[model samples]
Target: VMRANYRKILVPITEEAKKLKIFKGEPLDLNEVSNLNTIVEIRKLIKNNQAKIEYLVENKAKKKQAAIYLLTKTKVEYQEILKGLRKTAKKQQALLDNIVKKYHEYPKFGSKIVSELDVSSSVLRTAVKKGWLVKKEQEIYRDPLKDFESRKQKNQIKLNSEQTHALNSIGKSIQKKEAKTFLLEGITGSGKTEVYLHAISIALEQKRNALMLVPEISLTPQMVKQVKERFGDNVAVLHSGLSEGEKYDEWRRIRRGEAQVVVGARSAIFAPLKNIGLIVIDEEHESSYKQNDTPRYHARDVALLRSKFHKCPVVLGSATPSLASRARAQKGRYELLLLTKRANQKSLPKVDLIDLKTVEFTGAQFDLSIPLVDAIKEKIAKKEQVILLLNRRGFASFMLCRNCGFVLKCPNCDISLTLHKDTQQMQCHYCGHKEPIPRKCPKCQSEKIRFLGTGTQKVQEELEKLLPEAKILRMDVDTTRRKGSYKKILDGFGDHKADILLGTQMIAKGLDFPNVTLVGVINADTALSLPDFNSAEKTFDLLTQVSGRAGRAEKTGRVMIQTYNP
Candidate 1:
């Protein structure tokens, strides 16, 4: 008697939206956003006599669960698909529109007893369901769940409604894109990584391989750790950091199908992984993606083209996503998923810029901003680590003739020669031209000479004089040119063995440190004041990233940026 009021209904949703979200035997709005029009359409279908909910089911066998909500019942079947399924299934079916749905999970099997006089009952009773029961079990197909680690592996990911919808839709569109290209542009700290991981899992389940790329080597270890932790041994690492033999072995493993996924810096785009189903690029807008050497190519652009060649999709992730990616998403060239929240217990650091223009440090032979010195001392007293970021290296920028005001210049190139007090030599940073310290100026033979401008080495020396007990480590090509020197330096700072970490542009990408509370920008103006169009952007990203290093976990953190322009 209650089934009489359960008149069948149908709802309207975008065809594209429907094609990706719905699954077989799945309720309407399964993965789609519910709307007023959808509700009204369903309600109208329930109110009309022309609509029959039972006819919505293509097969009477699968319609047994249709009894829960009559309003959502429709004459349409779930046409969305997963990999290797038809690109899109748009054929309409409203014949079994009278059926209602069942809300209970794991319904009990019932006998086919129905009253002969009831038309609907008689129709359902004679449908003769033929599937879902095991007829002949095969022993070879049976296996213990403990045999595979994946069977016991935990599902750590918790997706929001939008992410769930995206997964369902993306699964359905895989087979449809034999000729189509798709991109995912998500913002900073956004769970963009999870989305890509979800997609990669699907690709692997389909017996295909995947690829991922990041911009900087500094960020690779963190990513590699995450991927390896998630995917296990099936993952391989590749990048300039690896030995040639190691890279070649990884490439071979990729081509032979031994490794299903490879993650690395820009060059990994050419990893030669076959049957590629997905490609993910983290920090897609980074300039590091562009190859500066000959046969130059942009990693992101190349990844897109490679994905096209393989008929796969690309997932591009960034906290501060690049303008190009944003533009593509705006133009509908890529699907945009916004994960505005940080992954775990983390927060963006507070940035405090100390203007150096007004601070008087000129009392000495050469001036260092007083606010910066104070901040350093304050951080030291508080027992929190500090990082002094500068973009230049060398003891001093140049040597000068105080008597004649003549500056020393490089002989080979028309550039100033930097003074290296540690070695008592004047060297051209560009051409490597070096000469012993002269008693008199080369030009006017004046004996009065002064070293001009501070560099990384000078900063290290000054900090020693100011904070004698502080452990200082400098990281740059100059100090880390040896094989494992970079790793040694990073280890020292990472373990809190070093109280102060100072360097050129090497340490700014995304070094996660928990104890770093004070990030001091020795000279923010160095990069911004450089003669380059992208200087501002590079400086901004670097500054923001460095500041992020402070106060990452629980303990409060602050940043002191001392710049001439503040």
Candidate 2:
């Protein structure tokens, strides 16, 4: 049986029976049921709905067990019991004395008390029998962020004139409970996040909740940290990176109104938050906000709908707003708010373009130019960090037989299979088809093969050879496959354990490293040749956003773009 219901049962029929022209609802002998490829449902199989159904219940966030002790004996009676047991039962006497001294702190977790007093359950039962104490069970909440230490903001950040103006506009909408949308067009390091936080504070002051949506899972850690530092335990995080237990506990907390702020990825739009006063979508132009699968929906559209229901303000913030959003702002459909300067009063990074056609290659591969390599070396000598962007992830974009003019491609997909040197396999990124690296061409027994395109892995190898003394950390889909791997890599980089960080577009935006003083784009023209009509727009947005990553802190920064087209 494939499935069953209270009144019916579903069974799969073999293909042979269908070939034999067996019609639906046609009664078949039990012997004939073994050979068919069809679906059959038997009705009225369970009389009075007496069929037994079983399911597993996932209650990871159930009520916890606690212990509370109260002294039933009076002070004088306790003293008499202790005095009488001092000589006969020294252990009981000591236990009784300790319980008496800490009776006021009765309501504590059972585990806490056990670890603190170093006593067993049998001893506690004996004490209860002697009337020295009373024990009872209580329920407590399971804290998902128990290990996360709340680092409250030591000194409040003073907002600039533009930030104050933007906050004031959002504040007015929140105060009047108006369902309005705002397009916050701010350059990188323009303090848009500060405005969002201040608006959230105002919402909380009005006794309302706030919901924040970030485009990528990579951005969630930093955003959650900032929000947690501001609101402490009042914030709950929801994202696919979290475990099932953590998600369940956080969901329950939000439902119980224990958390006032919700921060997560795209799916966070459906978070069970009530009385929302504001919704903020950071990097609003990112395509990651659109669900590609069935039940397709965009978080931005959903946020607008939710604003209508809650009568709240929705803020769409981005350094480079999408053309659609910009058009809307131009049409006066969305209230436009602009921030013209960096929050730290620093100048933007200086960017230089290098023509790959004329520039000298730094290594055997033509991925990194000499100028970019020299800049990286300079930064390393000064104890500063660098960021390199490569839009691809494998060791090589494709494997080709130079002699036969043939390329290895996935059978399932027509696209070329990328060569991964670490895995010694050619893998198709689209369909996940993998095969061993080839020595001789299958079509012609020629061994003249070459890897033609640059990716993050190949660049990493080249960087290591070029700068053997420098520490490098690579971030890509291949390296960050395990849970919590994102946090580990980011934390390592933030702690200055690596001299250079390299990755694909995932590292292009929403990353802040104060020590990074140089940024390089291996191939700035990768996205310009795409088949989509919006390819140019996407390429421009990416370059602008990534260039902003440098020179964010007090130190000046430099950027280098290498392209053959230019």
Candidate 3:
């Protein structure tokens, strides 16, 4: 399973070689010699019978060589940390609370948090003196959920009959301590998340941990909140948005068994959690679960492996299961549980597709059709909101010189640089290379350069022009680049602060806002044009997910999908 093997060449100092000052080899740590080329050379020598170096698989903590070390509160140090509890100054107490929170969050390293706590060194010094916190020279785990406020104990929610049945099936596997795979296929708004939460409760009740994998960045915060709210501070979240310190602490929490529940993105499947009672891959159909890089491994596949190793239950839950998983469930390899109806008994939204070839354009922009504009205006008039998904960001997909027909492209990558109006730069979506937007073509020096191809930013601009009174909140990679921007934008829309919410694919899934009565897909053909075989499946999933976000409350939802191909 190892991708590369590194070995250190060590030779005892010999009088002849030492006196000559030409030693053949020196004592070195194995980790310090991580060169693949050196390993290949040694392998060749061994194959030729020219060398007889022994291979040793050293079993140690995976992160012992890491730069930061964890400082944990000793068992008897709890009271010491809380010394002079009431008499402590308000500011000092707050800083102390922060330190205590970190202690509970994970084995927080002494070096990372002390300087940043906005407290004097004496506070940390006092804790050390009282044996309240001990600095140990060991690698620490990164915790992304470190900043999450610790919550009070929450009561377990009651499950409906369907959720009970699913939990019962999962519970049986946990009770038997046998490896089993389950496919929990449910429609949108079917309370699949409820089933997952209850199953996790069962796993923890049995004194075993659980690992849950979400699909994308959009799902992480929403799901993490739910899991954390249910499991309290014992839950660790792993995702890409987390800073290095946060990730390290969360990882260490799982590794050391400090965290009982793990909720994260695709890479969370590899968390060093032992004796896991349950593994869940939420939104199992998402392509994001499949790693696109080397040592490529699907989260589903890894879940199955860990389930087998730990003799636990692995649940794959999705409104639309992938074809491969559905086939497996069909063949009885995985036990399938179905939730066909909405948990709230609300009717599904009405879906209407606008054919661009036949529909009349609303304005000179030629992007938002007349019917879509009218729908948005109607929603705004009713005090409801709208979500517009363009599946593309930036002001335009490319810049073209009208005179010479020269197109602007990224020098480092083959893809064209997207014109970002907000940043006033031509940015490469793939490589992140950016330069000032060009007025004249770099190649032909043509003055008439045109921004071609519509994007979320362009659609947002058009919406503002068409509906001048509508308040719009744009959520995309460009708009929500900051750490907490996703939640901020979603919260604003939910609070009726924004009448129109527009964005790329990130806004398409796992968003629930009842006031969002109308969902307009400015262009639905983006994913369909991909060369991938499952492009249709992806497009279908996206449209279905985004459409589901409309009118989830008492109001009936309406979706208008604008497509060129019908």
Candidate 4:
């Protein structure tokens, strides 16, 4: 005997069952029954009445359909169709006119037309029925890299002896289907990327796929642009910066074996592209490769695992190799390839350290020193560009009251709330908590409030005041919160629209601007002050990578590091 509905039992005439609204000879949904004891008692009565039990089925999520409807204009005469339609049917007429005007010669997206014109599906169906329009349902990928223009012709870059040797060594592994790992330790401006591109081409030539992972989303644009220019539509990019639809579409493309080359940030290591002939992890030393959240996986380790599964070679390229990767090479577990000279045969930028404790500052904030300001002026006068790395965002690090020594902090994380002048809000970086900037100190109600510490926004304000004519572009998490903002900022800087590109750590690496002749590190001690064990290593990596952004072209580059500790 099995449990039965309380109402389904004929002999359920007890006081408790009546209190629960259970009636005899009435089918009751067990879900609506509240009291467990009453339900059990009613089930016992039903079991004595020869009732049987049935188990409920759990619902499963349905698979998402990737196909979408596509609309195109047919050869039917639009004027005749409009003439046949009643003049009162203005919506249908307008949609027909738009389809003829915009999509007469080519296929147009049906959803785009519907949203843009606010036309309903009924109108489209009527038009399709009239034979004035054609509808075809097909799976289409939402291209995230659509903004990047493809190169009409792929220019063959002449690789130097070092680059050629590295490519050849990687090529041998690809040819032999050996799951080998190689440590490509090259200087910042050495043609490591070029070597990666050539090796990707070799893998494609073998009718196999390839994956390239960058450390940051900021770097993805430049790398994607280069790869797209080389491989065109065959390239797919995956990163958090893309919208969910874009990521899903790109993922679908990779899974369907449409994209031959997949480039993205750390999470892209899981792209389902079978027959991977090569895997390249750029900036291998970057700590960003390790995911801090659940299912914490490092991309470098995943790349090695994928290489083993596909029997392909893995390339770990970095200017400053992590100690673990370097040690592995030393232990003969991974082959080490060195590229000492710059790819363009140019000299490394001359790095000068400014003693912030001794040198006079250009502004009251003491963020930019006299030498740095003067060098910036010189570069602006020469019509060159400058990249200023502050490594922090917002206007101020924290708000402090001089009278009461009170500091505003996030309630959730207990971290100082950063003052963002643009939004006029105090925001916590770790937990995303935001509050309006207080007029006075919350603790003491003192009017004597001061914002301390420098950020990219404050330095940008200073730069504008110092170099009035300099066109500045600020790139941080605040400015780049919108979609396609990274490409916009980088493209604007690349086109020489901005003389100074001010940003945080995101701007520190994987950027190549030939016109950028000078790079200024507003404060070099920020990273070194961290209590972490690898803070010093992170500091060195930041300095080395950011310094590489300057003088990449014919002009010699210069870097000034302002550090009070130095």
Query: How high is each candidate's TM-score?
Result: 0.65, 0.85, 0.77, 0.82
Q: Please provide, for model 4 over 30-104, each residue's C-alpha lDDT reduced to its tens digit, 9 standing for 90 to 100.
A: 566679886686678666653443445432322233323345435356656767888899889888677567654
Error of 1 at 374 (Å): 3.6
Please name the candidate that would achieve the greatest TM-score relative to the true structure: 2
RMSD of each: 26.6, 6.9, 7.3, 7.0
* Cα lDDT, all candidates: 0.65, 0.84, 0.80, 0.87
TM-score for candidate 4, residues paired by index: 0.82
What TM-score does candidate 2 reach? 0.85
lDDT per residue for candidate 2 within 275-375, as digits (tens), equals: 99999999999989999998799999999999999999999999999999999999999999999999999998999999999989977998998999999
- Report the C-alpha displacement of residue 452, candidate 1, in angstroms: 1.9
Number of clashing pairs per prediction, in order: 29, 7, 13, 0
Model 3, 418-451: lDDT tens per residue?
9989889999999899999987789888788988
Candidate 1 minimal-lDDT segment of 10 residues: 137-146
User: Model 3, residue 122: what's the lDDT?
Assistant: 67
Report the error of model 2 at residue 375, Å. Answer: 0.3
Off by over 4 Å in 4: 1-127, 130-134
Mark the 10 consecutive residues where model 4 has the least summed lDDT.
1-10
Pairs of colliding residues, candidate 4: none
